[model samples]
Target: MAKGERPKDSRRLSRKKTKQKIFFDEVCRMTKLVPKNKLTTYGAIARAMGVDNYSRHVGFALGKVKASDGVPWWRVINSSGRISFRPKDRVGEGTRAKPFTSLQSIKLAGEGHTFTEAGAIVGWTKKLHDFNR
Candidate 1:
């Protein structure tokens, strides 16, 4: 290898990390556009970023954001307009379990969002912000 040359594998890894950082930054920017009283879906953000159907990547990027960064991570939810919490584990005793209360729901409620008994957002037509529009 030349004195200034990096290993091919190391170069590829560096480029991958750089791309991930760019994706994460774009996700944060889109999340910021969701106003206090409005919401957007992970799929929507992915679409806005020109990567339609990459909702899980959107979620992964948002998960990397720190609470103090002011990105409003809670404003993003599943495509069905519900807070997407990981399901609680059920041990072998045959007892039902529930996931912890969603902080995203709490934040959205404080912004005046209403939910159905099953927890889908109500009046979604008016509340869901379309950044592409």
Candidate 2:
């Protein structure tokens, strides 16, 4: 079978599983990075942690982690510096895109990070670290 193909009856884990595992590990590590409110991209973590060809795998891994874990999964985003939109909520629950963005912005603001009218970081993370003294 090719890399993308899966055989029947063997219960083989998909290739995505491996990348997800790598992603999970990276997320766990990222959770430990200092100065809360600092955002890291999927590509940043992938390259820092040595995962090859698996930026989306980082997002997938974060989605799978349990909420009870307190993993700060919101900090990971695309390379273009945008946070991931929340997955559609369960029945009767409300959800919104850019949920993490607001939280991140608030946290960064407490640390004196600035944002434009469109609500971007505007070098907030670096500023936070610098302002921390």
Candidate 3:
């Protein structure tokens, strides 16, 4: 499919599912470009895909990626440069459970991304990968 064009199956599926797949695919592709130790926000990925208001959709897409997908899902974060996943215990009923935030933080730290004492990414604006530029 052409970039920015919806998939052929879009017409047959529910609107939400179709958009989710498109946003998911775009996020997966763009995430592969983020270099180690650098990061981008869910909002940044959404903007890159030309969906400025779909930042949460970017998060949804990342949640669906499997380890075998090789999408570097860990490189994406919330706009505040914080890990977006809540602890499993804090998740409400019917919500998707997430792996521990500490695990995500550890992985980012291993890649050389620094964090503040309170756990937000340190100097996040400076560390963001500006794909648009």
**After superposing candidate 2, which stretches have Cα over 4 Å from the reference?**
1-11, 14-23, 88-114, 124-133
- Measured on C-alpha atoms, candidate 3 has an lDDT of 0.79
Model 1: how far residue 111 lies from native, Å: 0.7
Model 1 residue 113 distance off true place after TM-score fit, in angstroms: 1.0
Candidate 1 has which clashing residue pairs, if any? Answer: none
TM-score of 1: 0.83
lDDT digits (tens) for residues 1-133 of candidate 2: 8898757744546656675575587667664463455666766666666665667766776777676877766555555554455453122334575333345444446756566666555764453222122
Question: Which run of 10 residues does model 3 get worst, by summed lDDT?
Answer: 86-95
Superposed Cα deviation of residue 110, candidate 2 (Å)? 6.1
lDDT per residue, candidate 3, 73-97, as tens digits? 8788898878887343133334245
Candidate ordering by TM-score (highest first): 1, 3, 2
Per-prediction TM-score: 0.83, 0.57, 0.74
Model 1: lDDT of residue 85:
65
Candidates 2 and 3 compared by TM-score, better number: 3
What TM value does model 3 have?
0.74
Best by TM-score: 1
